[model samples]
Target: MISINNLTFEIGARALYDEANWHIKPGDKAGLIGANGAGKSTLLKLIVGDYAPTSGSISMAKDLKIGYLNQDLLSYHSDKSILHVAMEAFERQNQLHTEIEKLLLKLETDYSDDILNKLSDKQMEFEALDGYSIEFRAHEILAGLGFSEEEQKRPLATFSGGWRMRVMLARILLQTPDILLLDEPTNHLDLPSIKWLETYLQAFEGAIVIVSHDRYFLDRIINKTVESRKGKLTIYAGNYTFYLEEKSLREEIQSNQFKNQQAKIKQEERLIERFRSKASKAKMVQSRIKALDRMEKVDEVDDDNPEVNFSFKFSKPSGRHVVTMENISKSYPNLEILKNTDALIEKGDKIALIGANGKGKSTLLRIVADADNDYEGTSTKGHNVSQTFFAQHQLEALHLENSILQELVAFAPKHTETELRSILGCFLFTGDDVFKKIKVLSGGEKSRVALAKALTADANFLVLDEPTNHLDMASVNILIQALQQYEGTFIVVSHDRYFLENVANKIWYIEDKKIKEYPGTYQEYEAWSAKRVVKAEEPAVKKVKEEPKKVKAAPTEDNKRLLQKKNKELAALEEKIAQQEILVKDLEVELAKEEIYSDAVKLQDHTRRYNSEKASFDKLQADWENLAEEIMELEG
Candidate 1:
């Protein structure tokens, strides 16, 4: 647990926090949220002792372990494999394993009671640390974070900056520290990887404090919300949705109070001015003036809302089918990512391309956009279907030496300077900001510029990949609104669920080297996928029952061996079932703890895990019984 008391942190002329008090208890999962440069990341740094407070103090248990994932990717040894870097999280466990190996070597030569005792102690420590499963868990985590088995074996230097950041995140997750401070953990993750992180954090036993722009991620994982604004911290006892509702109400009430106080002060001032020249009401005037002096002025709330307004202009309308692809296939030298995939994009269809990382979503988008024409496919753009493609690295493609104004002028040289400045202002860049060089802009600013250029390109179709990666919540909302109002067909590959839910009317799910189109929103697509999973499992259950009825021959020697194998498997399954049951019981006990139950999100997660473990135990028990019956019949 960590506590901050009257924490005051300032940087030069700006005070980010002033006499702020906050406490993060054990099992607390809080989302730190605010606009860009609103001190969310600064608070994380303060907690990690990287930034000392200007006044007051931050206190925590001396033995508390903290793990922090910074926005920037950490540097790793070039020669070390990605897996090797991740396994460093379990340094102590790995050391114990090494000690165990050395002791075994010693025992082979000359063993003594003292040496044997030491080996026993080390083995116990290793087992307690779950050393046997460390490698497997490490690999599983790496795979979840989008690292292939081959990629895991590759040296860290071979990965891109985004992949390197994922490796850093994996290491922090594996550390399982008492407290986790994550800044933009989902910035580099795809939708599937983000979901994996959500599930993993749900099961984490410690506290979490994360600063992320992904609203859907925060809603699923965080139980509490802490907002930083105007040198103050406000805590919400619920998730992002709850915070929004509460903040709205609070803002309305505060606005009303401020207006009423201003009105009363104005009336008193008028009375004082009028009566100051008259002796008939000297006492009342003095008293009113005293009250005015004693009154605390309510500071007006600053409007932090982003004002973005823009519309796409096209030269001409496209055909009913914006794009069509037949038997599209793409392959690299080492791997085939897409195989005979077919897709159709109709006019005005807003499609969200979603899948796991490296699953060819971007490749398919590129193919459709004509950015890459080497793929084997019959890809054709419909008549008058002018298109603009915004890749994930589109911002990086901007000329760093050019000013923001110059960048837009380069895109549309025919537009007047006044018109260009007006367009820039619509995207939240105005006056001096328009003159700032592209190299000096932040990631969000650069993304806005790129998007502004794309929207103004006079194209009827847009192919955008990961356009929301570096955008903050406000910018993402603005982009969503802009895209919604555009009268053009577009295909977007993004991991922001909130953005997708608002802007996308269709879902193009990429899996197993194929594209499946679903005519619904992202939430509806999720429901459809869940139903498909359930339907798929039903057939497996039915096949398991039907297979036993078809066996009619007497047991042979091979059957005996199979039966023995089944028996051993059954025994192992039963042991696993017992262990799982114990875990479920322990979780139940944890659920009974007052602190755990008080937090609704944490309680729901525990209950869900308990049910899941219970279900697995039941399935294993059923398998054991089925095997037992099969063995008995064979024996007879």
Candidate 2:
């Protein structure tokens, strides 16, 4: 548990936090959210004591352990295997293991009772700490984070930066500290790994503070939302969805109060001026002036979600079909990305390419973009097609010597300074910000510049790879809006489901070295994917043949009547069960709404209704199952 008391932290002239207070209690799951420059990551570092506050203090519960997973861990390397690296979290157990080994070696020589007793004590402690199974636990976590058993045996230095980050995440998880501080842990993960981490974090008993741009991850894992804005921390009682709703309501109320206070102040000011010359009202005017001076002014609400007003339209539209690939096969040593797979991308397609890391989503993207000619494939672009490819690596393509404005201006000579600046404004580079050199910009800022340049292309089809990387939620939303408004074909690879759901109309994934398409929105794809899993688990219904005639005569007729009655009952109960299911769902949704949460009585009432409906639905399901089994018995 940690408490931040009136924390005021500054960097030179700018205050990143001003009198911000937040209490991270045991078992609390909090999502730290804000725009790019709001110091979300800085707050995390301050909590971990990596940075000291300019004023005020941060206190933590004594002897509390903390496990932190951050991007900086990408630089960490060791000759030890990933499994060994992860198992290093068990410090006491590892020390005990070494001592036990020494004792066993000594026993082989001396065979003394003292050494035997020491060995016994060490073994007892090891077993108590579950030391022997630490390797298994480490392997399981590594695998969940997208490492193979064979890969886990490989040295940590052999992996890339992203993979190394996953290894660090595994180590932190193995540590199982009292509080876990994760900064964009989902950035390196694919969909499956993200889901695995979500499940693992949900079951984690310790407090968690996560600063992630992935709102989908925040919605699922964090129960509390903390918005870092204007040097202050605002807490939301629920997840991201609830925060959005509650924030809108709060802004509205604050806006009205601010308006009312302004009106009242104006009225009092007039009265003060009118009575200033009159001796009889001097005391009253003095009191009013003092009251007005001492009044705490309400700050106006800030619009965090800025609109992308700049229009982005390519000059040309491609033919109906965009990209076609046939007989595609890509192999790298022991791995095959695609094997004789065919893919078709038509015009007006907004595709979200997703899946695990090793699935070769990037390989397919390269093939589509004509960036890789080494793979075995027949790839063709549509007639009159013009395309632009955007990736994180493209950030380096920008002219560091040039300002943001100069970079775009040189890239698109056809567009005037006014037009270029307009686009830059949409990318959050307004006025003097456009004069900032590309070399001085943050990663997220440079990413925005690169994205803006990509949109300025005269191309009709766009290929984007993890475009949301290094971007805050606001910038991601801007990209989403720009893409949504653009009437062109594009395919983007991203693990941010919320962005994918909003910007993409089709979902594509790699399976068996083939590109697979799901012709629906991300939410629909999620539902269908889950339903497919459920369907796979369902038992196949066995067709019951006509009941074989039994030797019993009087009982047979009664059995037929009983079976018929039960069949009717089952049908009726099923119909009722279907309606009850809807009722329960409606009540559940109602209970989750912001309005219900704002009112205790409404929440309680809706919860009671939901529970009652759920209980009745369960009872109906039970009755149906029992009756169906009886009817089956009667049939036999």
> All candidates' lDDT scores?
0.85, 0.88
lDDT (Cα, tens digit) per residue for candidate 1, span 459-485: 999999888877878778778878988
Poorest lDDT segment (10 consecutive residues) of candidate 2: 537-546
Clashes of each: 0, 0
Instruction: Let me know the TM-score candidate 1 reaches against the reference structure.
Output: 0.87
The top-ranked prediction according to lDDT is 2
Candidate 1 clashing pairs, residues 3+ apart or interchain:
none
TM-score of each: 0.87, 0.84
Q: lDDT tens digits, residues 1-636, model 2? A: 799999999999999999999998775789999989899989989988999999999999789999988788888979999899999999999999999999988988988889999999999999999999999899899989999989989999999898999999999999989899999999889999999998687656678999999998988778789999999999998999989999999999999999999999999999999999999999999999999999999988878888776576677778998999899998999888899989899999999998889889898898899999988869999888999999899998988999999998888888889999889888888879999999999999999999999999887899999999999988899999999988889999999898999998999998766788999999999999999896773322222234455564344787878877887887787678778877887886775455654444555576667668888888877776777788767766
Estimate candidate 2's alpha-carbon lDDT, on a 0 to 1 scale. 0.88
